[model samples]
Target: MLIDLHKATLLVIDVQDKLVPAMADPQGILARIRWLLQVATELGLPTVISEQYPKGLGATATALTDAAPQAIVVEKLQFSCVAAECLPESLLAHEQVVVCGMETHVCVLQTVLELLALGKEVFVVEDAVASRTPASREAGLRRMRDAGAQVVNREMVVFECLRGASHPRFRHISKTFLVGEQP
Candidate 1:
């Protein structure tokens, strides 16, 4: 199913400062997430950021927080963000959730499952989520897909939201974000 921008919320899961360095392709993951955040902000989509155990794992990365200063940051010890009780009412009202974050096999996977179980249409940004090992990341993506989560990339989510080149934000988003990158 195509993601509806109007009914969608962006859920940025556990991309903490302390945990990022060890993740596979940290720079690439962060760049995709930052780009996603920029697009979400421009589109005025509500965003919820989940931090897993801040005291032990540290806060969300500065770059991510800076990218979307207005995003709601929710601290949680639960692997599944749903259990954190941190999702904002505005975001919870949305029917579709676009998720991007770290450790695909653990936090991200569990969160996607929970979101799906909640009857929300879940989309996992494959490129934006990562694990320390390629195997784990692949397994997580596979399992999420098997569990009915749509596995998508950053460009797919952006362009799908835009729908057409004639869209007002299309030119700006394409020129600024999609430039030098293939969808």
Candidate 2:
């Protein structure tokens, strides 16, 4: 099923400073997540950013926080955001969630599984998430997909959110954000 922008919230999980450096293609993942955050902000999607034990892992990267100043920041001790119960009511109310962030096999995977269990539609952005190794990254994606989450790319979410060229921001979004983006 296609993502419904109005019904969806953007969930950025554990893209913290210390944690980011340990992931594979750290810069690339950060760039994609940052790009998605910018698009989500422009499109007016409610965004939630989770920082897992920030004191130890460090806060959400400045680049991301700067990208979407309006994002609701949540601090969680649990691997799964749902288990931590720190998410704001506004974010939990959404029917769908577009997710990105670090450590695909751990935090990202646990959160996606729990979100799926809650019966919410979960879309995991592949290129926007990573692990220290390609094997673990692919494993996380496989597990999430097997558990009923739709694995997608950043542009898929963008197009689905915009729906089509008829969208008022289509021209601007395409030109500004999606210039050389590939599927």
Candidate 3:
């Protein structure tokens, strides 16, 4: 089944102020992730954001921080979101999860695997997740795919959420993500 927007969430993991500028492709990753968040919001989907040790790593980026002011920010030390007591409460298991954000080999990969093991389907937006090195990012994606998680592009997710162009929120969500063509 495709990702139903009514039962989907956009999970932003560790896209923090300090961590972002250090990424190999900061602007590109952030742009795609922000697009994901915007489209999710436009479609009335829920969002869960995580901060990997905020006291040390700092807060989420200003743009993301403002994207959904109502979104809960989980300050976590664990690599997986379910491992964080307060965080899992937000996931709710209501539907599929579309994951993105930093440190592909660390928190993002770990969280995706854990979610999949829980029998929850996860879609990782490839270009939005990054690592300190290209090799690390590639390795992380390979491992996640092997674990049964679907690593797809941001546009694939946008269409799955849209389902059909006739949907009421189609144009709004589509334009927000800059989703060009359907697959």
Compute each candidate's TM-score over C-alphas. 0.96, 0.97, 0.91
Question: Could you arrange the candidates by TM-score from highest to lowest?
Answer: 2, 1, 3
Candidate 3 backbone clash number: 0
Number of the predicted model whose lDDT against the real structure is largest: 2
Query: lDDT order of candidates, best first?
Result: 2, 1, 3
- Badly placed stretches (over 4 Å) of model 2 are 181-183
Error of 2 at 126 (Å): 0.5
| 1 against 3, candidate with superior lDDT | 1
| Candidate 3 Cα misplacement greater than 4 A, ranges | 88-90, 179-183
Each prediction's number of clashing residue pairs: 0, 0, 0
**Candidate 1 backbone clash number:** 0
**Model 1: per-residue lDDT, tens digit, 77-120?**
88888877777788878999999898899999998998899899
Q: Which candidate would rank higher by TM-score, 1 or 3?
A: 1
Least lDDT summed over 10 consecutive residues: which range in candidate 3? 174-183
